[model samples]
Target: MRWTAFLCRLAVGGIFVYACLDKIQHPQAFAVDIHNYRLVPWALLHPWAHYLPVLEATAGLALVLGVARRGAALVLGGLTVVFIVAIAMALLRGLDISCGCFDTDGGHGVGLDLLLRDLVLLLACLPPLLVRDSGPALEQLWRGRP
Candidate 1:
C-alpha cells in the first residue's frame, strides 16, 4: 500500500510537471490555448494562463518530493477535474482544439481519448491522498526514517 501510494505520487507529480513545462515557458501561447477552450472569461484569461502553470509545477514538485503529498494530490486532482470539464465542454460544443496538456502549441486535439487519460490521472491521485504513509518518500527521510 505504501509503495503503491509512492508510485502513484511519482506518476501524477511527474505528469503535472511535464505538462506545465511548456506553459511556464510560453504563457502567451498557453493563453491562446486557454482561449480556444472558451471557458475562461476574456478578462481573466491572461492571469489564469500566467498562474495556472506555476501552481501545477509547485504542487507537482511537492508531491514528487513527498512534501505535502496529500495536499498536492488534492490540488492536482482538482485540476484534473477542471481539465476534464474543459475538454468535455469543448467536445460538446463541437469545437476542435489542442488539449494544451504537454505542450502549449501543436498538441493533440481534445477528444474522448484525452478525457479518458485525464480520468485515469484523476484516479491515480487517490492512493497518495488516501494512504498515510507512502514508502521511500522524502518526507520519511526528513523525519529520520529509513
Candidate 2:
C-alpha cells in the first residue's frame, strides 16, 4: 500500500512538475493558451496565466518530496477538481477551447480528449486523500515500519 501510494504520488506530482515547466518555459505562449480557453474572464486571465505555473510547480515538488505532503496533496487535488468543473462547464456551454493542460504548442482546442484526461487524473487524486489517513493502520498490519 505504501509503495502504491508512493508511486501514485510520483505519477501525479511528476505530471504537475512537467505542466509547470511547460508553462514556465513559455509564459507568454501559455497566457495566449489560457486566453484561448475562454474560461477565465479577460481581465483576470493575465494574472492567472502568469502565476499558476509557479503554484503548480511548487506544490508538485512538495508532493513528490513528501515535504508538507498532505497540504500539497490537498491543494493539488482541489485544483484537479476545479479543472474538472471548468472542463465540464466548457462542454456544457458548447464553447470550443483548448485545455491548455500540458498542451502541445498552442494549436489544440479543448475537447472530449481534455475532459477525459482530467477525469482520469481526478481518479488518481483520490487514493492519496482516501488512504492517507488510514495508512498507518495498514502499515502496522503489514509490519512494514513504525
Candidate 3:
C-alpha cells in the first residue's frame, strides 16, 4: 500500500508537471485555449490562463516531493473534477473546443477520450486522500532526528 500510494503521488504529480510545462512556456496560446472553453468571461480569461499553470505546477511539485502530500492531492483532485465537468459540458454542448488540459496549444481536442482519462485520473487522486500517512513525505524527514 505504501508503494502504491507513492506511485500514485508520482503519477498524479508527474501529470500535473507535464501539463503545466507547455502552458507556462506558451501562456498566450494557453490563454487562447482557455478562451475557447468559454467558461471564463473575457475579463477573467487572461488571469485564469496565467495563474492556473502556476497553481498546477505548485501542486504537482508538492505532490511529487511528498511535501504537504494530502493537501496537494486534494487540490489536484479538485482540479480533476473541474476538468471532468468542463470537458463533459463541452462535449454535451457540441462546442468542438480543445481540452487544453495537458496541451494548451497543441490542438488537443475535447472529447470523450480526454474525459475518460480525466475521470480515471480523478479516481487515481482518491486513494492518496483516503489512505493514512500517504506514503513517505518530506514532512516526515523534517521531524526526524539527525
What order do candidates take by lDDT, descending?
1, 3, 2
Query: What TM-score, over all chains together, does every model reach?
Result: 0.95, 0.80, 0.93
Task: Enumerate residue pairs that collide in model 1.
Answer: none
Which is the winner by TM-score between candidate 1 and candidate 3?
1
Candidate number of the best TM-score: 1
Flag regions of model 1 displaced more than 4 Å. 141-146
Better of 1 and 3 by lDDT: 1
lDDT of each: 0.92, 0.73, 0.85
Give the distance in Å from residue 133's predicted Cα in candidate 1 to where it truly belongs. 0.7
lDDT of each residue in 17-130, candidate 3, tens digit only:
999998999889899888877788988988888889999999999998888788999999999998888888888889987778877655678888898899889888887777
In angstroms, how far off is 16's CA in candidate 1?
A: 0.5
Each prediction's RMSD to truth: 1.5, 4.7, 2.0
| Candidate 1, poorest ten consecutive residues by summed lDDT | 137-146
Worst 10 residues of 2 by lDDT: 133-142
Show where candidate 3 strays beyond 4 Å: 144-146
Candidate 1 residue-wise lDDT, 28-116, digit = tens: 99999999999999999999998999999999999999888899999999999999999999999999899998897689999999999
